[model samples]
Target: MALRVLLVHQSFPSQLIAVLEALERRDDVELAGIGMNPYARRGLRYRQYSPVPVAQTGDIVIDDLASKATLAAAAAAAARALSYDGFVPDVIVAHPGWGEALYLKDLFPRAKLVCYCEYYYLRSGGEVNFDPEFPPAPPEVLHRMRARNAITLASLEDADVCVAPTPWQKSTFPAMLHPKIEVFHEGVEVPPADNRATDRTASGGPSVSFVARHLEPHRGFHTFMRAVPRLLRADPSIQVSVIGSDRGGYGAPPSDGRTWKSVLLEELNGSIDETRVRFLGSVDRRRYLDALRHSDVHVYLTYPFVLSWSALETMGASKAMVVSDTAPVRDYFTDECAAVIDFFDSRALATRILSLLRNAKIRTSLGGHAREAFHDYELTRDHGRAAWERLVTSF
Candidate 1:
């Protein structure tokens, strides 16, 4: 008989989509969820909420009271309505970040629980990257938030297993939780981009591309903009294409009428040559794949972040990448495999871009090695299926 499974997460499709997608494919496991709706159109239905800026801070605190109330109400409605034809799961796998699991523990006490552990708060310098403009800290606020995360930690104790994406995340939990933790990567299928060929240079210039949501300061948009003039001066044959959404809306609406993207573009006005830079706002999947495949080099920069799907996508596509030498990235790729540069140093970033543009042989070599590494360490669908089987068998 198939095992019935319930998955809980406040934010569903962001990181948990891979596991959900894998579980949905199985014939032996029943999957259901109590997660945030990514495409919810109505405000009356539970809307997505984020306390910190998206993509800016990884360690975020969702308002626990609101989340608990939402989950409890949903559970009550599910029980009264006999949702899913009175189906009760035997096991539960949830990402316990947003305190949605608090009510779930009571709702499904008999089911074996499994939690997805993303990160734990620490006091180290790398813990907080505060912005002076819209400051996220005074230490006290973080302390309160950490206390709220404790609710999540407590909920995980009820879990029979913990799924983690990286060693960095697995190590964050207590040693007792370690015994139950399993390491996995939420992987992406490499879209068919390797077959398509495109012009490497646009109008006698090297074609470079950047893929990220247009959030300021975090994804290193400002830093990349700073490096552009230097890069253009060094090699006149270079053009850049940035791909992302232009809407100013974040976790919620901005009180001010301007988005960070518009602000940055306005700030860099005449300094940037419109002919050399193109802002292709929110391209379709095919266009995104084309952008990655056609580029001579892919640039990624972040301040002490866990791995991004875009970074892995670039690797999967075998595009040469110039990545930031932060802890999370350095943990995986050694200096020999990728072009590493310090996040704060624009000169170093510009220099690396220039070097990669001038040498096609070195670019090809790095791209080859990166694809090999992706197959070895990053692909997760098969591994995730096996892990799900083990978790179900134990029950």
Candidate 2:
């Protein structure tokens, strides 16, 4: 009999898409999914579930917990129906961050449960209060943050195995559960060099680039924006491309209902020339990779939390970088591969960006090292393939 597998997530397979595709290529495996985005991957039977409404609402903290509980109950009902219909999976994999996987084991007692353990909340020593500019989060907000992780903690009780994308992320979980968790990144395909060409700079000057899912404080957009004027002061001929949506993803939303982008732009008014800066709002994969190829210097800054895939892709593409020296980056980035800087220091950031652009020899040398580092840690590379395969079999 084929190996029957089921994948679950609140939305699309945020980090599981590659795993889904890999499993689909095997004739010995059968695949299915339960999520909000059924079309994210092909060759899988999918069932969609929506959040059950909470009738009573009071404190934001209480309401949030009730909502997650409702989602878990609703999803459990759906899974029970699937079992009744004769789709009994041998193994179940889920990203249980949103509480949807809370009762899966109860519904399928025989199936081994493997969870994608993304991040565990901490009062300090994590992303919570990393930025000093934002006043300490209120007591109620902190309570809600811990409450949010209740489902993740609960789901771990029965998980046969758990996967974390990075070592730093895995460390955030309680020490007792460390034995059950393994570190594995969802790999990226490196496009052939000849397939894409670098974009030509208008003035023949070096170009710097930044890419993120959203221009939010958690990823250090404010720090990047603050460094721009000083960067232009040092190298007026250089151009910059900022790629991402103007919305908050990890951090709190903007107070005035304006995007972090808009607030930063307003603060930068009349100081730096807008002509030198181009805001390429959230491009597709092809364009994003092209941006990495064309960039002379790439800047990535983030808090002490889950690392972004773009950072790894930039390294894979062999782009010179000035990266923030934070916990998430310390695992894969170092002085040898890129210029490491403090997340809060705008002056130091500008100085490093200027230096990299001015020296082509150093840029190429560091970029070569960056690409080498990618192959060293990247799952898509040959060296990591066997380990990734072993991980799947273990699950």
Candidate 3:
């Protein structure tokens, strides 16, 4: 008999695309999905549900709790509907951050539950309070952060297995849950050296880049922008590309009620070369790679939060980079692999970028080491399609 599996997320196959493709290829495993809007794959069945609307009062923490509860209720209804169609799964793997996993165990008591524990909020040793420039975390703010973990804790309570992507990410959860969590990453394929993006600098001059889903303080966009003027002043021919939207994310919004990009750019108005800096807001994969390839160096910085897949992709492409010296980055890079700098100090960031830009040998060496490291990371000690299969089948 085929082993039945159900994968759950707000959007089916968002981060689970790799896992979905892997399972769908197996001859002995039956696959299905439950999502707010699940995609129609060739062999995989999907169930979609409209999430229940949540009403808001003035209290954000209370509103968030209500939102999670309603989403859980809506998701549970979809799962129950799946069973009504005679498709009970043997196991369920879910991303629990948004509260989809809250009531799943009750729906399928016999089925094993695997919770993708992405990250647990923390008042310290995490994103909050890390940036001193941001508003101080008062008692209410800390309380609100803790309240948001209601779903995360409940999901893990009955989970048959818990998975976190990296050691640093896993460490962010409460110590009590540490014993049950498995450290595994959904890995990326490293493209061969010859297939990497070649020198296609649009201006045919030296270039650098910074990428993220949003240009905000959380990803060190402000600091990267601060370093730009110094870099441009030092080299007239250097061009820079900034990727992602002008939106803020994962951190507090700028108090000035404006986009961080605009705020930072206005601050740097006369000092930096506006014409040389290209803010490619939200690009496709081809353009992203082109921007990356045309660069002399890439800069990726983030808070002590979830590591971006962009960082992994950058490594696979073998781009020379200056990275934030944070735990999540240390998990994938070293001094031998990429340039590490203090996330706060723009002066240090500028110096590192200038040093790498000036030295072709070191940039080449860093890119080479980064590629080697990318090929040998947790995907070996931790994951791959085979690893995902092994974990799924074990349940």
Candidate 4:
């Protein structure tokens, strides 16, 4: 009989998709999942759950606690419904950031629980106070941040193994949990046809590229935008493409009621050459890859937080990258492999990108080295699959 497996994530398999794909090819394992939607992954059996309605009157702390409690309850109920169908997993893997995994252990006591620890909230040396431009989060907000870690802590205490996607992310957890947590990159997808022949710079003058899930301050959209005017002024022929949705992903939304994109545009005023700069907002995967494949140089910046999938995608596509020297990013790339720069220094960013664009030989060498490093250092699906199988089968 095949081993039954259950995967859970509040949103979906953002980090586990590669592992799920690998599992799909296996004849010895059966897969199922519980998420906000059942349609996230095809073929796998899935259960959908939604937060139960709650009474409105409460403080931020109370409301936050209630919301998470509701999600945990819903997930637990879904697992029970799955159990009613006589489906009991041998192993359970979940990303516990959103409290979805808090109650899974209760539903499947015999199943080995593995929790994906994406991030741990910190009052200092983290995203909360990393940017001086934004007002420091208040004491109450900081307290709430600590309180928010309750679900993660609970999950860690319950898990058979804790997997963190990066070393820096793992470091954020309490020292007691370090022994239980291990580092993983969630792996990058390198398609079979991924080759330098796809470079479109043949017809265009250095297509400078930037990509992220959303265009927000946390991911350094403002910083990248600030550098664009100088970059455009330095090389009028180069065209820049900024990809992703104009929305906030982390921290609080802009207090001024304007998005980070609007704020940066207002700061740039008429300085940016609009015709040369393109905001290709949230294109499909194929289009995004085409943009990266054609990119002469890719720029990625972020505060001290979770690494963006876009960064890995760019590196996998073998594009010369000018990345921010943030804590999370340091684990994947170094100065030798990528043009690592301080996130705040727009001038340095512009200069580095300009140099990369002008020197094709250097671009090819840097990009080649970066791609090789990713493959050699266990950042692909092959390595991820091996590590995941080891952990899943250990119990």
Candidate 5:
């Protein structure tokens, strides 16, 4: 018998890509999806399912009264639309953080719900890592934030199973919910490393690359720019290639008023030569992978992040990384296996980079270990397939 499965998520391509790929391997499974079009760019919709329509509403509003009402109403409306279409999935897999799962239990009473639980807030300091630059909110504001998260918790009660990617994430939920949670890493294809040697003199000099969506304040881009001056001072042969564009614009603009990139450029103007830093705005996938292949070191600094796809990609490509010593990362790889550092300590980060650049043996060893770790934890396609198979079988 063919199993009918429906996956729901706001960010479809990102979280669902691995699961979709895994499901594709099965001959007897039917997979469909419902997701929001956050960006305006249109492409081929989900392979099997019709796309679910969504309004551009403020689902993340901080205010208590407005936030609760907005989420409740949206959930009710979404449930009604899906139910009216006569799309009753045997098994439903959803990412519940966006409040989409609020009324899912009521709508699909017979279906078993499986949730992708990303994070649960705790009283600890790491919860504020998303907005690290700002000081901690007042007690009342914190209470309100906790109250907001209650809706997320309520949604979980409807879930028959909950998938969490990291141990830290699994630990965040209450003890009662632990039995229902399963640790599942989103696996990716481990591409063979492009070991093709390049002439250092040809591309100006030995270059390191940072690839991400933007060089924003939150991503520690400015800190990296600051470290560039010191790094260049020590070794003039080293160059930095930043491969990404600003939020709303492409290419370099002349003296824009106080953008994060502009500020960094100004700060490092005199200390580091302009030629040493190259900001190649966003490039295609081939170019991005090529940059990773050619890079000597990849620096990934985040305040407190769950596993970043970019970081994992770099690891899969066998690039040595210097990542922040956050809970999510530490839960995955130890210091001996991968380079880890304090998030706020720029000096420590710079020192790690310098060490990796200087020691080829260390770099090679770390890269090898990173690749092994990736294969063990990240590239296990069969495991993901098995998880999906189990979900379908239960259905």
Candidate 6:
């Protein structure tokens, strides 16, 4: 009989989509998926379940636990319905952060449970403390952050295996859990970016791009925006494409009820050449790739946290880059590979971007190197697709 697998995530079709699609192609594998939204694509389907609501209690920690437990309960109910339909899973792959995988083992004791261990939060070594500008995490907040690990910890104790995208991310978990964890990134696929074939430079001089999921402090939106004023003031021909939504992710939202983009724009006080800068919010993949195709250089910045998929995509696209010198980022590229700079230094960021923009020969050389380095992280390459396949089969 083919291996019966159940895929679980709060949002389906995320990192696991590659794995799911790969499994769907195999005659030896049978797959079903569970997510918050109803999802069906590429001849595969998933059952959606509403997150069961929980009444808000005054306690932050208790309310968090209660809410997750409710979600866990909902997931458990969905799995039970599947079991009733004679679809007992042999393996369960889940993103456990939302507590969806909490009771899968109870539903199918014989199944091997695999949890996507994206990031393990540490009050000191992780994101909260990495930015000095933010007020230090208070004892209560620190306690809450530590408590936030409860769901993952419980899932880990029950999980047969855990997968983290990077070695640094895997290292964040306790040393004891290291034995169960594997570093497996969902590979990105993009052609090497060479602006030579394009006639964009004739249309406009030295265009560059910036991308993030949400323009927030954690992704260094403010730093990148701060760098923009100088780039605009220095070069009259230079144009910039800033791609992403004006919301927050990972880090806390602004206390003053303004988006970070608005805050930065207000801070700049009309200093930048707004006419040259295009804020292309949440562009489609075609436009994103098109922007990359037309650009001379790309900039990516981030805190010492989970690596953004966009960063990997940028490297895979093989564009000349200005990247932040964070621990997670160092895993993919070096200073020799691209222009690496301090995350907080807006001046250096602008200077490096300006330098790469002016030099075509240097851009081509760095872009080629970036593409070569990207192979190990690509889906079709040896380490990427092969490694993911081997792991899924081994289970």
* CA-lDDT, candidates in order: 0.66, 0.82, 0.84, 0.83, 0.68, 0.81
Models sorted by lDDT, best on top: 3, 4, 2, 6, 5, 1
* 10 residues in a row with least lDDT, candidate 3: 191-200
lDDT of 1 at 193: 40
Residue 257 C-alpha lDDT in model 2: 90
Give the range of the ten consecutive residues with the poorest summed lDDT in model 4.
191-200
| Regions of candidate 4 where Cα sits further than 4 Å from its true position | 40-43, 191-203
For 62-83, candidate 6 gives per-residue lDDT tens digits of 8878888888888888888777
lDDT of 4 by residue, 21-88 (tens): 77877888889888886565556888898888998655776777788889889988888888898779
Model 6 gets an lDDT of 0.81
| Candidate 3, superposed: residue stretches over 4 Å from native | 191-200, 379-383
Q: What TM-score against the true fold does each predicted structure earn?
A: 0.82, 0.94, 0.95, 0.95, 0.82, 0.95
Q: Which regions of candidate 2 are displaced past 4 Å?
A: 40-42, 192-200, 381-389
Backbone clashes for every candidate come to 1, 0, 0, 0, 0, 0
Q: Per-residue alpha-carbon lDDT of model 5 for 202-320, expressed as tens digits? A: 45566677776767644567667777777787787888778776663321222455567776666676775768777778888787777777678888865454556677777877777
Error of 3 at 227 (Å): 0.3
Superposed on all Cα atoms, model 5 deviates from the true structure by an RMSD in Å of 5.0
Give each prediction's root-mean-square deviation over alpha carbons.
5.5, 2.3, 2.0, 1.9, 5.0, 1.8
Better of 2 and 4 by lDDT: 4
| TM-score of predicted structure 2 | 0.94
- Which stretches of candidate 5 lie above 4 Å from their native place? 38-85, 127-133, 138-144, 195-204, 248-258, 267-269, 272-274, 281-283, 378-382
User: Which candidate gets the maximum lDDT versus the true structure?
Assistant: 3
